[model samples]
Target: MAHKNQFQLLASRRFLPFFLTQFLGAFNDNVFKSALMVMIAFRLAADQANALNNLAAGLFILPFFLFSATAGQLADKYDKAFLIRRIKLAEIGISLVGVVALISGSNTLCLAVLFLLGVQSAFFGPIKYAILPQHLRKTELVGGNALVEMATFVAILGGTIVGTILSGASDSGGGSEWIGGLIIAIAIVGYLVCRVIPDAAPPVPDLKIDLNPVRQTAHVLREVAKTPAIFYAIVGISWFWLLGAAYLTQIPSFGKNVLGGDEPLVALLLCSFTIGVAIGSLLCERLSGGRIELGLVPLGAAGLTYGGIALSVIGGNLAPLEEVSLAAFWGSPGAQMFLFHLALIGVFGGLYIVPLYAMIQERTAKALRARVIAVTNIMNSLFMVVSAVLGIVFLSLLDFSIPQFFMVIALMNAAVAIFVFSKVPEFAMRLLVWLLSHTMYRVRHEGLEQIPAEGPAIIACNHVSYVDALLLAGAVRRPIRFIMYKPIYEIPVLHFIFRTGRAIPICSRQKDPEGYARAFEEIEQGLKDGDLLCIFPEGQLTKDGEMQPFKAGIEKILQKTPVPVIPMALRGLWGSFFSHKDGHAFTTWPKRFWSSVSVVAGKPLDADTAKSDHLHQVVLGLRGERL
Candidate 1:
């Protein structure tokens, strides 16, 4: 079957409502927060402005620390659609309170409303991620997440622009109250849209709600710890938020105080940053080939650090132009230069985050996914709080200007990224594989990460093409030991590559008992040394696309040295030049530059259930119904 296009997936009722709901929520968040910030900056007491603005920011983020644990538990325990609707209803109520505060003209009440909005977001956090896998197929996860991310950043830009414009206009005509009312009205519309979100069944219906924040938070942390990769991914995500929060909080002040820009200029700076993120998000689907490819995280982080430094350097170089014109202010040569740097930052940001989000969804178990996301939110909030405090300390004690501070942050981001990638060589190795596959062919992967990073992993895949091993090897980050037929393993030119890759030659027991014994012994030794050993249980390459009967060799190997057996299925390989399906194998390569293929890896099966028939069926399921 032909794969579904991005438009079709995006247009479905299942996805659109949730998309709109999330977009609206993000938009409203920025609108309200930006509007309030503007009010404090321009209208509030001048001497108290900084203190109050800082306090307001703190209040808004405090709810995440206090309520995210509860929110995560609730999302996992209840139907997501119902939970979302109720959250929307609460937004409507919060917006009403904003209206009342505006009419009453009380800054205190307005700040209180901001705090309430934060609480509302904390509740919505878990449902946002938990609902995704339910609505999207495994193939669509990357694209779906990209769209959601794109929409969110776009909404953030829109919100900042709207809030700035509305707040400025209100300042002139004493219509700030009316604008506040209008914001509330928009929020109510958002709630109504959320009501139309399709139902998603809860993952754990009988899951008890853990009301104790500390205990619940601990429980979620323990759950994440079960998967080492997932735990690290969470830490990476938290670090991103920390880096982002600090940079975002500094931008407005940077533009106004450092760059000598006005309110509109500050909005433009934010817009540039967010637009970069949106672009990055959209590019993820194409780059990852519709899978959660974590390799891009390093690439994205590199861009962020580079862009930040570029922006800072540009800021330091600011000078008076020939004419004091609006165009000069908006797009002077220097301003243009800065904007270019910001856009690069956005492009890279897109590369870094999209894959991480996809990995989190793909790796975690279904039941615990939402709660894990909730844990992420809590971490994000805590990081942001820390960032705010750090920003204040750095600025006050060291007297670092905004430009200098951003430079420091850029350097810090680079340092942290280096640390992460070094600790996880798998990321770097995957990046190498990703680069090779994209350069050579339009490769698609389903279960690439299923291959054990270390130790004995018996990869049972249906033999379809000569390139199957290459594709599998490229997808996996670890070195693999492929048990191959002796004839193919001795091919003059290909033999060198195979030998270097440490592939073992295997022969039928009746044909060569010594060769068979050697292959089995080699595999056992590999397991002892913690190496990934892959065997095609089908024994020979398929002449046609249909699967062949399982070879009992895999059963024998496991019987003697039992280890985790991972079942895999490779699709769209039969018709390629490497496959024997055509009159002459390797005669003609596929015409398309990026034709899609899928390699799915199912959950590891224990040795006891690793029977030949059961393993055969599992491989078929991973391949889906396509082949």
Candidate 2:
């Protein structure tokens, strides 16, 4: 089937209602949680409020630990559309209970409602991630995720602000019955929207449902561990939540005790942070060219650490404002600096998360994608719980101020990022390419590790620009033999470059059957010589900047050579001066001396699994949707 357009995907009944359902669910959650927090800070006795607030936070997150395993199983076993509708209905019931608690003005009852909301969210977790691949195309995953994240966080900011305002209004009136009513109304809307979500059939429809959470959780863990990359991605995701939960839990306390800001100011701080996250999420689709680019993970982590340090320094410089204005909310010497740090945190937070999410979706088997997401949800919950406890320790035992706490967190983040990148050099390599492309033009790669970086290999890339082979040569440490078109090999000016590089040329079977036969023999000889041969499987440059189908010539070569095939993707070359775009080569140079380009290489695929169609898809995934 042809891929759906982005707008169509966005507007479709399949995605929109589920989007709203999740959005409203997130919003209602923050609304109640924030409202309760406001009550603890402003209305209850200091000791009593602290105890109640801490308990509420713990109870809410407790469900993730207890129910996430069950949730994953259910998501993998049931139709997600039906499951989501049920969960939304559950939310309505929970919100109604919240209404009764609010009317009674009982803090205990309100806290219970918070716990129940968390429970509902935990159940929705697996289905939330599991349903996407069923509805969207491979190319749309990153953009879709970005949109979802943007919506979720926007809901969070709005819910937080609305909840705080509503709680404050009720306190002034000596009651908060209206806050409960507002939550119930939102829950109703969430249910209605969920009913409209498109149906997603169960992946493992006949799979057994594990009623025992402990055994089930263990099983899920084992399942995930089967794929090391997926497991690490889960760890990466959980650590991010740990960092976020730690940072977010401290914001209100910091605003009030450290910055001496009021409730409204706290809302402002949250708004800025969420806005930064929203903007960053939107940018992910563009920056990654609508694919999961794990390289951004390190970049995001760097931002988080720096932003944390910046916040810490600004907190240390806390001073009273000389003047206050609407702009001063952000510019008020104390608050302005604080908001700046928060915004930076959010920006980097966006960069860090969007790609990890895309990676999880892309790498996992489609059948288990949602279950993996549920695993992530559980991990996030566990980390947040750990964070809350550590936070308390830092605040009480260590006598660390909020800013100092952030500084410590920032340092830890740097350490973790370095470790993860070291383990996954692909991220580090991409970072190198990203930096180099932004700095130099006409960059060329050669030697490619003297052709045998490890073993016999066949390197395949799309035919795009005149300099593609050069760029690949420059980036690879191995020496490689290029299989060029006959004409390009015979070109007067370029022939010497190819000859010096030891490139081989071949004509099509129709043009010269004997020549094609001889070229395959040469490739086989090169493989026997333990040399790496790079072939452009697309055979010719794309006239419209889209990948053409593989020419099947490589199939014959691979059939004969029997070497590992490593697919490479070259991006930002289509619009370059030497590209087939703009009617011809070297006709239109970029305005800048250094145009951004990327040469992404995937891990080697065994000759057994290196079918032409599979290789094509892998290349497309690597090139991303934009190419």
Report the number of the highest-lDDT candidate.
1
Task: Return the TM-score for candidate 1, rounded to 2 decimals.
Answer: 0.78
lDDT of model number 1? 0.79
lDDT string, candidate 2, 174-196, tens digits: 44777888888999998888888
Which regions of candidate 2 deviate over 4 angstroms?
Answer: 1-9, 40-43, 172-175, 321-337, 436-627
- Cα lDDT for residue 393, model 1? 81
Best by TM-score: 1
Summing lDDT over every window of 10 consecutive residues in candidate 2, give the lowest-scoring window.
442-451
Question: lDDT for each of the candidates?
Answer: 0.79, 0.78
TM-score of each: 0.78, 0.74
Tens digits of per-residue lDDT for model 1, 454-558:
666688888887767777776764567788988778876556657766789997999999988998899888878777888888888887678888878888888
